[model samples]
Target: MDGIFDMLILGAGPAGISAALTAHARGRSALVLSSDPMNTPLARAPRIDNYPGLPGMSGRELLAAMGESLEEQGISRVTGRATAVAPFGGTFMVSAEQDVYRARTLILAVGAQQGAKPFPGEAELLGRGVSYCATCDGMLYRGKRVAVLGLGAAGEKDAAFLERVGCQVLYLGPTQAKKCEIKGTDRVTGLVADGEEYPVEGVFILRDTVAASVLLPGLAMEGGHITVGADMAASVPGVFAAGDCTGRPYQIARAVGQGNIAALAADAYMRKEQEKQK
Candidate 1:
């Protein structure tokens, strides 16, 4: 396959970065794929307060440190969402909207998205009155009172999309009190702050991410998690899973640990393939 990576790690957080660094250190071509607002959970943590060495450091600080390490390692970064991974000939290709990245081995470090705070009607009316992806279901509430339940870029974009569709869009997020940078009127309503609720026919949770499911197929997902084997391989071969996307115990250190192990396994698998060729 053309434009294939020897190893392509999805997500830019701790796990993805760690795996890319390790693969690079081993002299394997590696690329990290991530979307915007890269910090994710680390950016939201009130403070680190834990995780060794940086006892008092904030989560954002730790995240920055890790990001710096990846940069120092000369690891390449691709800003795109992984929509799916499929076996292509003898290698794997991670698909995004713009292009398809090939990798003999893949590391799914795409971390779990941040949890959503459901309002009174948010959960009760799911599908009926709530949604997560505007791209997926924006047309459902055309010309209706639809609220975007997030303040991040994704939320803002969703609001814009809804507004374009002639839906009454309300912007809501963690910092909804702050004046919004996104501009729209008529179909788009202003934001509703954190402590308040808005009367909308539907609330879309667009908190800063492209849903991971959009990228992978046949994923063993249960409640927004992909199952991984002991070696961190998903049910699929030549593919490994790590970090929060693998499920609970969503800690930076744990993600780093999983990334390291997954890299080793991928490396070993590649070596075996080379030997088989001989």
Candidate 2:
């Protein structure tokens, strides 16, 4: 687990699994991370016909087949929601709760960010008083009150961790989170929820899927999709994006195709990097 991976794909959907398969074929060590593999949108689809060679197959069936493929290929899978991805030296650091992974190349196939939009000042005050990982930033608010807007089990764990860290935690379940508002100047100061305001130093927003932009800072985005080139390489070097997070035409075939391209692109990037390091 301490060894740096050649490619770290975020998500276990068709795109991510495809990327991992390709990476393995290319002889690269790849890791696939997903918080809730069972909850992937693909798994919810009753039937998919557009994908060739798999007519009349259920989404979950296809997903299971891909899982089996990964197992056969010996690709590693990790069950954790990635909170942040930051550049570290010539590689990258991916943080997921208590674990941190290092990779020379990154493939953001984490599907699309769904549900509620960001609150009024959430984006602008991201580092100031807003955070996604309670474990990563909870200690900064020690002895201070903070609001945790959690979506599922991951969010619940984040809130509990904040409490354990000595932060007076205000747990706003998913339903209440949608009605919450962040209010502050220069930094987070209060949270508005359910027609009531509570004083807090920071607000932690934890959800199953994180936006591509939020996951990797400085990555170019176009209307909620990660900007990519013809080779599937993202704006950031050593980073690639595929599937729904890349753009429209949300089809299984499209996602799988993009995942293939991303895997190849990552392999090429890693080769160039290794050559430079020599």
Residues 1-278 of candidate 1: C-alpha lDDT, one tens digit per residue:
25667888888888888888888878888888887534477777867765777777776777788888888888888776554467888888776644778889889887886542233433334455555567767888898887776645666776888899889876666565342222123332322444454555666766545344544556566677768888888777788888998888888889988998888888888899889999
List the RMSD of every prediction in angstroms. Answer: 7.6, 2.6
Name the weakest run of 10 consecutive residues (lDDT summed) in model 1.
179-188
Sequence-dependent TM-score of model 2: 0.88
Candidates' lDDT values, in order?
0.71, 0.87
- Alpha carbon lDDT of residue 212, candidate 1? 49
Cα lDDT, model 2, residue 133? 79
Candidate 1 ranges beyond 4 A from true positions: 37-39, 114-152, 158-207, 210-214
lDDT of 1: 0.71
| lDDT, candidate 2, 1-278, per-residue tens | 45999999999998999999999999999999888788777888999888889889899999999899999988899999887799999889998977999999999997877752567777778889999878778899999999998876677878888899899998988887667788998999999987799998899988787777777868999888899999999999999999988889888888899999999999998888879889
**Residue 70 error for model 2, in Å?**
0.8
lDDT winner:
2
